[model samples]
Target: MTMEHGRAAGTTRKPKVVFVLGATATGKSKLAVAIAKRFDGEVVNADKIQVHAGAPVITNKVTEEDMAGVPHHLLGVLPADAEFTAEDFRRKAGRAVARVLAAGRLPVVAGGSNTYIEELVDRDNAAFRERYDALFVWTDAEPEVLDWYVALRVDDMVARGLVNEARAVFVPDDADYTRGVRRAIGLPEMHGYLLAEREGGAGEEELLALLARAVGEIKENTCRLARAQAGKIRRLSGLEGWDVRRVDVTPVFACMKDGGAACHQETWRKLVWEPCQEMVRSFLEAPGCRPCSSIRPARR
Candidate 1:
């Protein structure tokens, strides 16, 4: 189904959807914003954790200033305590794409939440099969380098008051970490530290040790999550037969280590931004291009 743009006999022409998918801390948000600005599109977050309200530091959500006036949907729209299932996301995100299409703008869905993204993009439905044109641009980086990057991000989140953010929603006796935003990597790891902070106000040295251990655990767990996410992206690639254009941002991270933030930005523009923009432009204009799902193409 890589031809006829996914059209079928008696099938309605569906809207085009661009996807920016990758592991955590690989700069998917930045690239999504860049693609939106270039193609006059809006960003629809597919990250399940990011859809919850608050815990922005923990989730590493795109800040308002970073969005640069580009509209974003399904981002922090749900309550932090609310349960948002994959089916919930499928319904809402479908509406979001429709709204974007109604305004005659492209839809760029971006997030590391591959399961949620898969639910929305690969669901078996007659109208959905006939109605979507998907182009995925996956941003990836080497594990060692990206693990370092995610560690740095954990430190940055701490500096941004992640402990206090978790404290706001921390429950003392609750062992169930599988619900809502509490499932975020940082919060679950910090459970021990949060307990110490709440119960033992006098154990100065022990509390500090607990806090440090919690932060370290957060970094380690976050790196694990990133690896798992990368693996899931690979799984989706094989299972769904997607036409994925991968952009490696390892060089950008390396530049940051050698030069600094400025150098990293310059390297990113060259390695990640420019190529994605060109790819997006071609995707938007290419004829006979189609969403590479398993759906059989209609006979002409």
Candidate 2:
């Protein structure tokens, strides 16, 4: 991989990557698309669920419309039943970043899957530091705020055909949930309800009860996932010394919950979008990394 536009004149510089990372449902993906547009960049998915094929609704994969025509890699490219690991992600993500750099575009790795990020960024910190200048942006919200938003998003997903999408991938006889798209949150949560409905021997009231229970489980599990993801980011930032620039987007969420659609857009630009644009601007303008005794970030 070579650094093209990220370089200055004839000077060879390390390839630059900005990671948009944080807990689920924190608008990380949307912010990433905006960043890519501002910086002539492409997004590479690091979210494990999103790598699997199909089940977009359940896995919460960003759609083409959401991606806004920005080139995306490692997203929805794996077979639905394939088992993917952090090591697998590291190899694929490295190639994806290289391809973006070769095309003279900045590379933005965006997702909630922190292990994949860790594998790519920290597994070989010394060599990684030598080869790339990286900026880590953590888009965060208050835990309580996120708890509300996640449940709301799960409802929205269901309204947008989450149950049907999950049904399409449902396996009635087999309930392994250990690997592949079946392991996605919505699929496992919906298993009991889907199986019961498919079997067609249950009463109407019983089916409704099971379905409601399934939806509740989906919401609760997703909330738990957001918490776990946040914990991982904390570990990476604190124990591993990742220089993560955290931007609390709680205002954006709070406003969305109460404000009109028009106000929502305005609040987003002011509180989340504009600030991130400036952060990436400054990082790009900064000099590339120099070899040092340590790659650890200074304590925040």
Candidate 3:
């Protein structure tokens, strides 16, 4: 068996990994980029779907423009049809983190996938696992606001050729979701509409109505996924192994909607970035050890 060590003995300190985790549309990727920019960090994806090559539309990939010149790894690298397990993420993310640190950069694991993040952080190789100074940052929003964001995002996906994206990977009604991209949230939700449209039995009006209904279902399903993610984070935050901090982004979004990008950035810096910045700064200041959680999640 081959074992990889994260750091050499007598090295100044083991590398630290900053994980920005949350449900879809919670600005996890944006905040990760902010931290990476401030701390000279690179992003290693923990979202299973985004790791797959192609399907950027379906997986909601962070655009290169939005990345603000920071490097991102483990994104769109795997084949779209490939089966990626948590263990797979562990191996790839570990190497990504090591390489980032080797180049004198911090590693930011940013994504909405709780399982992949947990596996990479805690369940990976035992030798290197102990050496990692890991910090978990969770982004959250109000339930209604999350629902609205998800619904709007689904609408945007439709505008961005979501139907075509679904058609490329739609499966049979009885198809098992475990295979290929069938497991993706939007694909399964839009499968019926794609199939009906391809079959050419439904009239134009009926097809349009079906498409509308499918989009609605996708929004509803996405909200459910968000709730499930919250439950996962709740359990994860209670664990004693890793330092966890949760940031509620509802106010930021509201400011953005009412004000603009400038206002959003300011609010983000105040609420999200500064706290994470303090954590990263403290971790770098006290190298070779995990930073204690200084900010706790808001009490519900």
What is residue 148's positional error in candidate 2, in angstroms? 1.1
Q: Which parts of model 1 are misplaced by more than 4 Å?
A: 1-14, 126-129, 288-300
- lDDT per residue (tens digit) for residues 1-300 in model 3: 111122335665556778898888999899899888887888998888888876678788998899999999988887777898888888888888889888877888899889887787667445445877777788888888888778878888889988898787665656566654566778777767778887899999988998888888888888999999888887888765656677788888788768888998899888777777786666656643443454565343
C-alpha TM-score for every candidate: 0.89, 0.92, 0.87
Backbone clash pairs for candidate 3 read: none
The RMSD (Cα, Å) of candidate 2 is: 4.3
- 1-300 in candidate 1: lDDT tens per residue? 122332335655555788998899999899899888877788999988889888888888899999999999999888877899999988999999888877778888999889888888778553443577777788888899998888888898999999999898888897468877778888888889888788867488998899899999998988888889888887776754366666778899999988998999999988788777767766766633542332222111
Error of 3 at 116 (Å): 1.4
The collision pairs in model 2 are: none
Taken over the whole model, the C-alpha lDDT of each candidate is 0.81, 0.83, 0.78
Q: How far is 214's C-alpha from truth in model 1 (Å)?
A: 0.5
Best first by TM-score, ranked: 2, 1, 3
Task: Give one digit per residue, the lDDT tens place, for model 2 in 107-134.
Answer: 9999998988988887765455567888
Candidate 1 versus truth, CA RMSD in Å, comes to 5.7
